[model samples]
Target: MKRQQLALFIGLSLSALSATTLSTTALASQASDPQTVFSQAYQSYLAAVKADENVQQTAKLAYTSGKAVYGKSDDNTANLAINYAKAIKGYGDELNEQRFALYNEAHTILAANHGKQSIETIDALLGQANYTTSAYKAANFLEQVIDIAKTQNKPKFVADMKLEAASLLAKKFSSKKYREAKNYLEEADEYYQENLPENSLERIKADFLMASFAEGRKKYNQAIERLNRIVNVFDSNLNFDHSAELSAHSKLIGLYEKQGKSEEATKHCLAIAKMVPWKESQEQTPLYRVNPDYPLNKAKQGRSGSVAMEFEVDTAGFVKNVSILNSDGGVSFEKSAIKAVEQWRYAPKFEKGQPVSATSQVRLDFKINR
Candidate 1:
């Protein structure tokens, strides 16, 4: 019995030792070393950040310094240094140095791994662009990046990147660089046709930008077509609740007027007129505040009375042929009233879908508040 008990104790001891050894080895294999953990985490972070350039770069630094002594194996340390520094900079963190170094490394690595002709260099170039301060500098960077990406047949990235480039180009259009900006926008359109959904907002936006650019060049027809798509094709309901819709309507109205479509212009003008609320009043002649352009004697106090005038409103909504049916008193005041009346615009009466000359009477009253 004594021998058997001793043998059992020895067996238990050996089993415990073996179990402890296996546990240590397994832990070591998994993430036993802090260095190994850091290395793995760094690589994971790099891959995770492929699309987000703005990710907190401290992720790399944390991984570099997070390793415990046991994890600080030479192989793990070297690999950690390589990959982390490859995505980041080894030198003390100057924002420019860190940015430029990462870009340089990204370009070099992409060229080596993805082939010299790959557009992956665009990724690096874009990173460099993120650090640029000047609009022109940023545009220049994005242009090159987009060119390379498109050359390497990356349709989606090229398309996405072109949005920023096009905006910059539009801002710089007044300068000699407008053509280059236009070319960048054209390239963006090509990408949108391939990658974006038909009738997508992005595609619509691209069309809108091009249209505005055309309009800036006084290409009215092209601008009208683009504006029409936003109203007719994209937003068929003509919802005017938002500022964008209002702006679109305004553009369409201007285009109509420019193209001599007076009828259409009148329709829009009436729509705008309807938005302004009218106050019901019992006064025969409502008090009219003179527009600053009206030549009124500053020293003279306003005299109150009504002057009834007959006017002809033309097809273009212009008031013409003003004649006073009844005058209150002064000739100077009457003349001033008639002159301002001639320049007044009216909502022309419509007959058979055309604005016709209509006779109307307006009573003008001048009142000044003390």
Candidate 2:
């Protein structure tokens, strides 16, 4: 097992002891047949998921499986479904120990029997990938799917697999398996190049994923390059929507701003607001704001000390209220600190890249000794 897998396994086994409580709350107040009720709930969940593109399809699928089991009226199957959902929802008190472990074992057996080349095996593996909290399992199973997609020479399937794998990578970027993720993404990129033509949606998607990985690594300039390519490609095609172009523009502006390239940043910011009506809030306007900074204050002299200050900025950029969120036996010195911060300079807050008056929270640390 890899380092990430080891971390995931250890994370799964802990010293926490607790009892399982099944939620019959929805069932207890039942006013209809269990099968009908479950079917309706399952359908509602699917619609709720489909209506929102951001909804994780995996959650909905799990619900559908539960509904099927419940509709059969088998006590054990119904119990398994409820427990699986509880584990998924992080409902610690409602977890079913036997069912949860059994679900895992069932998935493993299914995958082992069908082999990775079978679509049935892929579906079972993907289901397990979706329901678990283990990042390692998610990444591992997704990799397996990608492997099958590649060997199968299915363009659309390959694209879908890569995108899903990239998304998981973005979530687990901080883990030790990032290198493996990069390798998979590179493989995906090659597939896109061979299978997806210029200006194809899949190519654009591939570009976006590579750019996101660059951003995660703090390679701002590289990220900018990938995003620029995406924009240029779409622009030349004249078939893509302005919204996609605007997204790339926003990303570039943010990258430039983070790089402290004020001139480049301003240029992109203006372009974004003009190109997209919703981005006007990013413009610079006069707003009372304070940039908080702190220095190590381990050693100092005198009766002065440092403390945390919380203040609210008004819509007009004025410091309206100041209070200590935390104090180290030194509330007396806070008044002076707040007074000084009130006069601080700030660029105006913008909503959607357009200049807009807004309330922003700021934190200040006064180090009396430093």
Top of the candidates by lDDT: 1
Residues 86-200 of candidate 2 have per-residue lDDT tens digits of 3353334234333335455545544455554655445445545655566687777877777787787777677667666665565544375677667767776787788777676
Show model 1 residue runs off by greater than 4 Å. 1-136, 147-153, 191-198, 237-241, 270-370
Total clashing pairs for each candidate:
3, 14
TM-score of each candidate structure, all chains considered together: 0.42, 0.54
Which digits, one per residue and each the tens of the lDDT, describe model 1 over residues 1-370?
A: 0111000000111111122111101112244455456445544454445554622464465334543431333323322333344355334447556655545555565566656555545555555555444556666677676666577565665675676567555654436557766887787778787777645556666777778888888898898777766655435544323344445556767666666675666555554334333233321121112232223563264555456788786655566788989866456557778877765445445555555566777777655566
